[model samples]
Target: MGLAEQRKTLGYSQEKMAELLGVDRTTVGRWESGKTSPQPCQRLALASTLKISLQDLEALLAPSQAVERGAGRPKASDHPSSGDPDEMIRREFLRILTVSGALTVLPLDEAEALADGVYRGNPADFARMNSHLWQVYQLARTKGTVYPVVRDQLATLREALSGARRGNSFPLLNAAADLFQLAGEVAFDANRYSNAAASYALAASVSKEAGAYDLWACALVRHAYVDISEQRYREAVEVLRAAERVAVRGDSALSTRHWVASVLAEALAGVGDLAGCEEALARAEEVQDLPEGSSNGGWLRFDGTRLAEERGARYVQLGRFDLAEEALKKALDQSSLAIGHSYRRRGAVLADLAVIGARHQDPDQVVTYAREALGLARASSSGYIIRRLRSLGDEFGPLSRNHRIAELGAEIAALRAS
Candidate 1:
């Protein structure tokens, strides 16, 4: 029997299996569908969970030889295809992940030369590819799927840097900085705070070396998120303050400084500085006046589209439920959020609203918003949303005696395994 048959026979739903495996539900789906195989590190646990030997598990995972021969080896279509560009990018990235495994074992010089031949010595090509990867990462339901590609890209980038001439190294450094931030993002989404911090630190160092002030500032902002996630508000403020200083050196036309201020507002709110948070948020609002191309869509997407949610979140932190509810409801009215284009943003706003309900001791309101947020968390497989929901779950202490609230808490707790 196939993996899916085995799973059913064992009476394990995909979500349950995913929880036991510490992976996204989509990852488990891919394994059963024969679209991908588990990594070597994951195979032993998977085999044990399946109540099968490692050798038996491999047989189940292997593709049918007859089907393979009939269809021939899988390959990217050379002709132009129509679909979401992000989806196309994801497929291409998977292809690269497979090929890069072999390249990683080659000597550094040889790997560098091979990469150079592939890209024809143009750093812009690498930059563009990295940008696409970031878009794909943002849109992907399963964030861990991007890890192997990011890891391989970093390896190729290291080889490129080691062999580049000093005169041509700046562009490579800029590319490296950008990719490192994406790497940090993938790690951060998976709740690997230390690894994320390390990646962001490297991004900041490389950005400084490349003389890309905006990139450097953005890296520092991301680094601050690790501190913020751990509730080290003072430390986050210090990092963001440094980010603000560095952003001053970035191009005035860019929204780098304003983005720093936006994040700074969150940090200030964490420390109970209501006045400071409002001031920083006001500075962030000035980004609306900047030209259309003020921020790159990849690393710096803050174009005031998130300000409403940010304001609501900051007020929530300071315990101003009335103001928080007003702003968060306004945020939900925005077209993108109303349409549910961004599962992460919508999920976060819903979780925040649920927190407001908990604060008011309104069990029905809490359950309503929390359930919707939980649905988004499951659909998107977003760790950020899961984290917000976990915080919301903590606020359910007084309401937990309610049967519905207790069930909701159990569901949110299950995401911890995911």
Candidate 2:
């Protein structure tokens, strides 16, 4: 029987099932729609509710005869909810948290209770818990909620690296790389650029040792972002060049490498190296040469349409107002239709348009786009977005006498100060 039928047999509504499973109704909907299957815990709950054995639930959840031959089964284990590596890493991290006395921020008893949960949980459960904690960490603003855990996370990641270096095993090395990448992300979010760069470099080295080229390219791209943030355009160019080479060798058809190249072009443009910028842009544009759906989506995902956005931002830096305006507008339109949610990307492009408008002395457009982008950036809790806005606000310095522009500038400055 289908999941829905089983739910009906158990006399449970989607909402009810979701509540029992500690998930949303949409998750239950996905399960019933066959888009995903329940986790082992949820499966056990479902089986009990349906008066069935775990074995029976497993069989019922298996691919049906209606599935076409040679078509792969959508194994539940392959889904993000299932074999999540992040969960395991998080549990291990928490163990270090207790060991390092970082958990002292919480009541001793509460910390022990959490440690107990970590100890009892399976790897997937740990991963899911970690993922949830990270998400919570991202949205949470309290210093009490962040500092202790983040510090522990950093310590855990460092320990992983140390452990990996002591061992020559590929698994240990790969695990270290994964932890380092996570550490880098956390560090970047905290505006610890040097730490982020160091983590990315370590990740790249581990990736090389593990023979994982895609991971190496990803690390380099992350490192390049740090360089770009510092306005070290020459260093950025060098980093991107190395990243481009690694990306090409690893997976030329992937969109990420091309996206890396596109951003690299922007860095090149920052230095007034027009020729190199155009060439890098040309290479980035070549992502469309791959046949549709050829990308693995694991790495090398440069599908090319984001060029307008990149061009808009780059041209804004070059003071090419005309080009920036056209490209920025087009990017805004294209991004509106693209699938998925990237508040960061949307906010960035809108901020670029704002900068373009500011450059052209178009007060109305500047205010409209900048305010909108600022709101989105705040909603996304993006430090990078805030930094971009601050930089754009600086462009309004020449118009400081204009009350409206000055107000906008002051508002952005306030955000940066905070």
Candidate 3:
């Protein structure tokens, strides 16, 4: 029998199983759905609670993945979610009153001690660790590969929260807020928008409670990206404007406002507000005047380094190729060459240059950059990059009589099919 069948036979609802195992109920849901497996540390506990032999549990887990996710089968009507990771995240957090029983009930002294342990480490240590995770995230080929590490960091933060007293929550709060943003990034890269939104919302809420205004503003900006992804440009602009107000009240030592303006430029561009987009881009460039080393890289990655690409993308949106190509080509030069260094970034810039080339009626330039971007999208395995490539894919239809352009179109179609 599969996991659901076995759970049914034992008269255990998902909540009951999670309670007995003392883990998030979402973990149980993931296991039941074959979306994930129990970690090695938890396998014994899972097997014991299920009242099955280890071999039998393995048997159940192994065959169930195919039965559940091999496609060509009808999903349950009521569940309304098949394999979307965002649904898993939303249901998991939505179902929880708190992360775990221990967190909900731990004594203040114990929580204080846990927070104390976290505080014992230098705040810079946590900042650096978060910064490194961003570097890794940017360099990874498959972004979902970062999810496990992000989840483990999340568990650690929750462990501290379980033992934290109110007065002791400051440092823990910083760590939690930063890590939650990272968690959101991972979910976003995996195309799990609901999960990303939830994480960003929690990050903003917790950062506000902790009185970390810059962090709070940063979280709001991250949340705005979800709106942008859905093409709700007006909504995104609203969110960015709100973020701007919050950031203005934040610490000037941080580049929170500058980051806000950078994203604001993109949102403005999305709505075809050329003047607003240009103003926002100029505001983002104010970061260059901030004291050197303004970014901790954890919460503040925009240190004016991305302005070139941002400007290029904005101009592209404004249909001003005359201004875009210069900035985009510069962005391509400034982009990294390290192994697997987020080909998505380079791919995006290249894709934009190709679009600009198309607008200029330069088919050869279009094919040249488009093919390079397609290669990066293939190598990086980033859906975001592929989506950009697909935009160019559509524009190529008019040029398909050119065999080279036709060939490139076919390749993109093949990639989408795969």
Residue lDDT tens for model 3, 241-339: 989889888889789999999999899899999999989888889999999888885667788877899899889988898899999998888885433
Clash count list over all predictions: 0, 11, 2
The Cα local distance difference test for each model comes to 0.80, 0.65, 0.74
Q: Residue by residue across 246-344, what tens digits does model 1's lDDT show?
A: 999999999999999999999999999999999999999999999999988778878898899999999999999989999998887883435325888
What TM-score does prediction 1 earn? 0.77
What pairs collide in candidate 1?
none
Q: What value does the lDDT take at residue 210 in candidate 1? A: 89
Please rank every candidate by TM-score, starting with the best: 1, 3, 2
Per-residue lDDT over 244-345 for candidate 2, one digit per residue giving the tens place of the 0 to 100 score: 777767754456577777878878988987677778788778778876864433223356767788877877777777778888898888878986436667
Better of 1 and 3 by TM-score: 1
